[model samples]
Target: MASALQYIEETIICAEILRLMPRFLALLLRALIKRCLRSHEAIYVTLLPVADQRCLERDTRNLGHDLPKHADCIQWIMESSSRKAPWSGKRVVHELMAIWFGSVHALTTTVTFAIHDLCLHPEYTEPLRAELEAQYIQFLKSGRGLPLLDSFIKDSSRLTLVESSILLSLSAK
Candidate 1:
């Protein structure tokens, strides 16, 4: 969604597509979007059984030397996969694409719905904002906790689950 947000803001077409997509009769449109993104990535890493492991190695080298240490899902995947088996670049890329697709969609939907609810219920906003701000400062200073923010996120995710009825109807079609 963050990536989509960039395009959505820069282009009316992307914004309109996003607005119209949810009302589509089926999830084919969303699936197409995911496939399109996947195909683009596949050009770099065929995600085939024979994909070169050197890409992951180069990325790791770049991470340590060229780029600053950063916490990222792909990095975690590389590290964890290396600890287990002979690193398969294809498997890592495949898993990374799947994880990215699931995370982007779920998080974007969750955050959007949460913000919409917060806007509708202004009464809860102030308290949440206050708690987040206070905890954010402490977090920046000590890096210890963010209990209220964490709870709010958990509640938001619980409240805004994609309706199973919608999924059922789509699948029936």
Candidate 2:
């Protein structure tokens, strides 16, 4: 299981299509799409066995070995209000993809964009660092965040969002 997972980890999320000369880029995009899809499906196929095992004993629906300890998100999702079942292995795998995108993907992408933007706009670096140092002291004193840092983070996130992505921005007080 570990070796198989290691192999999957080693698989590149996308092939080197961007490096191809301009003319070939268009042609290779389709191949890149296919490769990504296959990689995605490979993960689903890998998890089918575990999902099947978890679904087998619905009465005791405890996916983890440790009793009363918090189980992993996959187990929680299976038990969540939306998923009542006699769960098929395929359904479990599909749900895995859904849960991952909503939580893991969103968080990683948000952090990635935030970090990338920080690199792109070096002017804000010192100010943000100083703000964070000040904020840490303030937090220890009163557990409150300063408006300047909050607004900056919110605005940075808002600006970094892609055109096609939907984001509802709530003003930070």
Cα RMSDs, all models = 8.7, 8.4
Clashes (backbone N, CA, C under 3 Å), per candidate, total 0, 0
Question: Once model 1 is optimally superposed onto the true structure by TM-score, how far is the C-alpha of residue 55 displaced, in angstroms?
Answer: 9.3
In model 1, which regions exceed 4 Å deviation? 1-50, 53-79, 82-89, 102-110, 133-135, 162-173
For candidate 2, what is the lDDT? 0.55
**TM-score for each of the candidates:** 0.45, 0.55
- Candidate 1, residues 95-161, lDDT tens digits: the string is 6654554555566666776788777777877888887777888788998787766676777777754
Pairs with steric clashes in candidate 2: none
lDDT of 2 by residue, 123-167 (tens): 878888888886878777887886665676677678754321111
Which one wins on TM-score?
A: 2
Model 1 clash pairs are none
